[model samples]
Target: MKRYLFCEYKKTRRKYIFVMAVAITAVALCWGLYGKYNESALKSGWMMMLYQLPLLNTIFMPLLSIVVASRFAGIETSMMKQLCSVMPKQRLYDAKLIYSLSIILLSLLIQFVSVYIAGRCFGFSGRFPIELYALYFMFTIVPAVEIYVFQFSVSMLFKNQAVPFFIGAIGEFIGLFALFLPQYPWIRNSVIWGHYGALQFVGGDWDKVTRISTFYLMDINWVMFAVSILLCVAFYFIGRTLFVRKEV
Candidate 1:
């Protein structure tokens, strides 16, 4: 596994996967932080972030995964025939998925650190909830993993990277719209792309009259969260099997 992983890393060194991911993360962070500089926003900045970041994640993370997965798979579209003779298809599939995830995870951690720093710099009131942040990380990444699996599978199956990219773009719009439709919990839970919004643990209340905003903890949708993890696992096996059986 390590050998396969190392080989993937080497192959992708020139692909700018890390660079692109960092750029995407920065964009999302900036979007989340914009217009949040007012006194009211700063006072409840931590909770505001908790409320807003998942929405950003729903918009950006799937597209990030799509780009990264497409790049990883793009390098192999013409070379799969050669690669299969040299390595087991399953090993290759696993290595690519694991390696791509490592890149995504690091990108997310950087985003978290950036948000923390921003909170400190801007002096967000209220104590930082380390436990909630940890759960936030878990909730955020699990859905990303599920999305990555779906993206990677499509990337592997189709030589045209645009197919997966198009799917990702459309999925992002669907997921973003779904966030506003909270009345349908089942819709949010079932859409893999919207799980970030579905599992969000924080909710914000804004007073249009007074222009006041307050944040509160919402119930964690554990059932949906668990369902996401299961989807990731199931997709991994299903994708791997299809890739192995697929003729190179």
Candidate 2:
């Protein structure tokens, strides 16, 4: 498993997926910083940073997952068929899942570091919300796992990367619209792409002029989190079954 994981990492790194994910995350962080600077009356820049991270992740990370998963699976479909033939199909599927997850973790790490730096730069004051940070991390992972599984499945099942890539792009656009449908939380929560916004049940309110935090919560949408995990697990098993049956 280690050897297979290492091999996938090398191939994925060669594809520049890691670089692209980091670059995209950096851009998102920069955008959040820009927003913070322009809104002077905002209370708790740290809270804003935390709130925006999941939104950015929702918009960009799924697409990143699709691209990375496609490139990772492309190896087998393109020229590695013979090499794959020598291995059990389930092992290959598991390796690909792990590789996709590693990319997700890398992206999350970049986001976390960037947010911490940006919060400090913005002069956020008061106790660091360690509990909130842990909850944010958990919330971020739920959607990420679902997106990775859904996109990775499509990428592996179909040899053509364009199919999954387009699907991911479309899903991202739809996710933006999902935010406005707050009246129907279930509608948004049901889709993998919308899980980011769904997880943000707790949020912050700030004064328009003072920008000082007026209200915030260390709470979350537990139901959405649980549903997302269940869906991710289901997707993983279904994808694994399909992948094992797929012709190399």
Candidate 3:
């Protein structure tokens, strides 16, 4: 497994995955820095940056995951019957799942580093909340995995990348719109693409007239989180089954 993973990583080094990861990281960092500058006066610089991380993840990660999954599956899809005849299709499917997930994890790490640097540079005055950071990290990763599994299934099920890519593009727009209609929290939480906004670490009440905001640790939507986990498990088995039985 290690050898296979290593070879897969090497293959990705020659692909656009690394370049896309870097570009996403750079854009996210710039946006966070800009948010830090604008919200610094509100005395929630750290929270502002942290909040923005999830929002960025919500909006972009689906598209990114789709691309990674498509590329990873492309290896097998391109070869089709020849590759399946030699290796167990299940093994190949699982490896591609892991490969795509590793890319997602790399993207998450970049977002974390960007948030940490922004916090330090903006002089967020307090004992750093490592606990909050850890929780937020888990929150973001769980939904990301859920998204990856679904996208991976779609990518593998379809030989043409355009199909999955188009669906992902539409999902991206849906997620962006979901962020605005917070009154219907379930509306967003129910969709995998909107999970980042659903499982937020920090939330607040804002007075429109006074332009004042008070922040608090947002309650974990345990039900939604559990549903996401269930979806991941379901999709994994379903994808594996479909791929194994697929006529190459």
Top candidate on TM-score is: 1
What would the per-residue lDDT of candidate 1 be over residues 1-248, giving only the tens digit for each residue? 99999999899898888999999999998888876478888788888888989999998898899989999999998789999999889889999999998988898899999999989988887898788898899998899889989988988888888898999888888888889998987777778888999999998888999989888999888899889989999998988999899988
lDDT of 2 by residue, 148-233 (tens): 89999898888778999999988987777787777787767767898899888456566678746644664567887888999999
lDDT of 1: 0.89
Clashes of each: 0, 8, 0
- Candidate 3 overall Cα lDDT vs. reference? 0.79
Query: What lDDT tens digits, residue by residue, belong to model 3 across residues 1-248?
Result: 66667757876777887678668767766755674244534477566556667777876788678778888878765577887787778877887788778878988888887778767877776766788888888888899999899899989999898999998888877777898898988768768888888888687677898776667777788887788899899999998998888888
Candidate 2 vs candidate 3: the TM-score winner is 3
Off by over 4 Å in 2: 36-42, 204-213
Give all candidates' CA lDDT scores. Answer: 0.89, 0.77, 0.79
Report residue 53 deviation for candidate 2 (angstroms): 2.5
Which scores higher on lDDT, 1 or 3? 1
